[model samples]
Target: MVAPALILVILVTLWPVAQSFYNSLFDYRLTDPSRSERFTQSNIDLERYATEYFYISRDLEDLSAQAPDDETAQAVNDIQTEIEAFHSELIEMDGLEEQYGEVDEMIASFTAISDRDLKYAEVDNDWAEGYKDFLAASNEELIALSEGAPEEDFSTTAGNVAGTLDTINSAVIESNFIGLSNYSRYLQDARMWQSLLNTFIFTIASVAVELVLGLAIAILINRVFIGRGVVRASVLIPWAIPTAVAAMMWGFLYDGQTGIVAHYFEQFGLINDASVLLSTANGGMFSVIFADVWKTTPYMALLLLAGLQTIPGSLYEAAEVDGAGKWQQFWKVTLPLLKSAILVALLFRTLDAFRVFDLIYVLTGGGPANSTESISIYAYITLFSQQNFGAGSVLSVIVFLCVALISTLFIKFIGSDLFEGRSR
Candidate 1:
């Protein structure tokens, strides 16, 4: 039974992480055709190559006939012969001729080759390198001939042929597999480190403030008071609001000229200027942290309240009988008994805070030179905005490792005391 459940857990949790780790091993990017997919071996984009090769052959034939001098004509014929030989060799490979014919038919009919198996054909690494080098040399020669051509038509045709060669060369996709290189590259990236530092600062500052305020709120509301249920319900309103909506609301509140909150903050001497809150790096960081604390503190309070209610009234009474004051009773009785609760609350909040995205994303958008940018935001920009899947996956794997490390530390240190108490 345990084995089956454990297997399910591993499948559900680790599969996506495993996929990301695999992608991080390659130089994958959706924006570039050559790097759109992970290639473990050199491959040819038959669709593109076959389509362009048709035009290239005709263009080179025309150029060779129209060459101004014997030397230019001979150079063009040599380039044409070399390219034709490469194409013949490519089509002669087993299983490629049939696909090449089908791609040729598709091109003739103006149909896109949508099938991957029919589109890309793997080739020997050495052949791919040789073909690419030859294409480069031919292009350079054609470019020189075009520049020095006596007639405008000759120059234009030569330049167009050279451009066609470049297009064909791009169709020859090389293997993008570079194991652990993305990780090493990002490890030395200053922006990555800065984003990480910003994440840590936001997590530490918000969680610390939330813990303190939450504890105080929990203690205050735990005592018998007027309309306690209403108070508790009201306190949860901030947490109950959707985070995006709350962030938008705060954005309005933090606006320099029109926001009441910023106006009040400036009036209270908290800031030198109202516009500083969103215009400066430190202010952007503070703005997000402050918004996060306001949004999450109620949740922390609610968790602590559950723990507070679990403590018996007898403990407090006993402390009082022993001549203990309120603060002493709290330290001696309340705090000691609330250890497990505090641990649970802190662990949950810390992990959540560390991976914070939506709140900060909507609040600051990681702007003001990315002072408020978290690891998640950086990963988002890399993965979606820039469309660099490999580098983005590297950042994601780093976040997972950091979260794992945090969990280990919390369980090893804070949880040890709770487990020991239970054993005792």
Candidate 2:
């Protein structure tokens, strides 16, 4: 039973990490048609290439006719002849003439090509490289011809011809498999480092405050009280609210002018002024940390409360009988008994605080100079906003590694004995 369960766990947990790591190896993006797919071999986007080729051939014939001098007309005709030769070679390779003709007709009729088999076809790697080199050289030659053309009106046509060659050049999809380049570039990026630093600072500050406040609340509620249930329920209101909603509420409270919370803080000199809280770098970081502490402290208290409940009441009574004061009883009995719970709470909160996105995203949008940007927010912007999948996956893999490291540290230093004792 455990073996099957373990296999399922591995599948669910590690599969996405594996997939992300694989994607990080490629230069994948949605905007670039040639690089949209991860190609393992040299290939051509035949539909796009054929369409471009058809236009280039027609334009070249018109350019040859429009030339001002015999020398210029012969030069234009030479380029046309070379393009025809290349086209013949391309279509004849592995009998692609039928597919090429079909794609050409599709373009002529202004029909959208939907068939994958007709769109992408594998080509010899050497042939593809040579063709790309020729296209680049041809573009340069066309630019020179346009600049030196005796007729200014004909220069525009030559420039158009060069531009069309560029489109055809881009249609040849090369392999986007650039293993580890994205990671290497990001490792040296200062923005990446700064985002990581901001994340660590936020995580440590919020988790530390939450731990202390949570422990205190747990102790307070553990005693006999007249309305314990009501107090307990009230304590959880902040934590129970949806994180985005809480963030929005905090945003209003942090507003510079009319916000009650910011006004009071300004009066107390806790900040330089009311507006600075959400507008300045240090103030922004402080506002996010304070908001996070307020929202998540109750969750920490709940976790610690469970641990507090499990401490046998008889032990505290025994400590009291031995002349131990309430403070001493807590120090000697409660603290020792709650070690495992504290460790577990820290592990969960630290992980949650590290991956924080929605709270900070809604609150600050990592704005005012990206001073409060977390790694996850940075990843979100990179992956979705910028549409740079290769770079985005690098940030994602880094976040995963950081989470795994935090988990490992907690288990090794604090959770080892707890698990060992349970096993025994």
Give the best candidate by lDDT.
1
Clashes of each: 0, 0
What's each prediction's TM-score?
A: 0.90, 0.88
Q: Report the C-alpha lDDT of model 2 over 1-424, residue by residue, as the tens digit.
A: 6899988888997887888888899898877777888787778888778877878888998888888888888988888888788778888888688888888888889999999888888887887888889889989988998998878878999999999988888888778889899999999999999999999999999999999999998898787879877877776898888989999999999999977899999899888789998999998999999999999898899999999999999998899889999889888999989988999889989999999999999999997699999999999999999898878989999999999999999988684665765676
lDDT of each: 0.91, 0.89
RMSD of 1: 3.1
lDDT computed for candidate 1: 0.91
RMSD of 2: 3.3
- RMSD vs true structure, all candidates: 3.1, 3.3
Model 1, C-alpha of 65: deviation from truth (Å): 2.4
Model 2: worst 10 consecutive residues (lDDT sum): 415-424
Q: Which consecutive 10 residues in model 1 have the weakest lDDT in total? A: 415-424
